[model samples]
Target: MRHIIAVLLENEAGALSRVAGLFSARGYNIESLTVAPTDDPTLSRMTLVTTGNDEIVEQIKKQLNKLIDTVKLLDLSEGPHIEREMMMVKVRAEREDREELKRLTDIFRAKIIDVTDTSYVIELTGASRKLDAFIDTLPGGAIIEVVRSGPTGIARGEKGLVL
Candidate 1:
């Protein structure tokens, strides 16, 4: 099963490396990871996505909690939550393809952030599936490059992570 584990940890040197090393040492795969300092400058929030059986996930959580820097850990996938990823696609948008690209962008509610005579950079943010679908709608061979910020999530209720 895939799990979105959100972790609050001390913001200090080598903290990220330690967390990643733990997973590497165990041979577990992290599909996506996004980390940044939270409002309380002393801490950082990490949203990590990984796939494993229930037992493996449980182990991962336990090991994470044992880390010196880890302040708290929550598996957002366990309850109501929201996830979003940002993707930017640069595609060939020549004279003939410009109209079609604009139409497709509108359909996906994406923004054409940059425009050149022959190409465009479109930015989209949504669930992973929505991003994938937008890519599928683009013309074949039109894609020049794609950059995605892996999924990040938070719980849906009034509750949240705090110091």
Candidate 2:
């Protein structure tokens, strides 16, 4: 039972620390977390991924509500939502392999954001699985580095999770 929780909280120093502390103190685990200022400068939106059973997830929600900074919360996983992750991979791309790599990137609809004589940096965004598939397609020895922005999710339809 993986859950994607969206939280709206005051955008202030120590706010993120407190939320993370709560999870640690409770022995809960957060797989991924992404937070940034929202349109309202006074608040921030955080999307966190975690896995737990129904009871544990209920407890996590309750504990989150008890935080003073929490303005609103929603378990996006419980409703219709979309999740995406972005990744950048640097891979060997010598002349002999350049065309093949480019073709594969085109198939995945990824872009070569940077390139050198022997290496290429690709940018990709999609479901986590899709990104993993792309990585698997590349030769292991060709991968120089990889960076990912963990999955972020939002609910569908006109409704939004707000105070």
Could you list the CA RMSD of all candidates, in the order they appear? Answer: 0.8, 1.1
Tell how far residue 43 is off in model 2, in angstroms: 1.0
Model 2, span 85-151: residue lDDT tens: 9999999999778999999999999999999999999999997889999999997688999999988
Q: Which portions of model 2 show Cα errors greater than 4 Å?
A: none
Give a tens-digit lDDT track for model 1, residues 16-81.
999999999999879999999998999999999999999999999999999999999999999999
lDDT of each: 0.95, 0.93
Provide the lowest-lDDT 10-residue window in model 2. 154-163
Model 1 clash pairs? none
Candidates in order, TM-scores: namely 0.97, 0.95
TM-score of 2: 0.95
State the local distance difference test value for candidate 2. 0.93
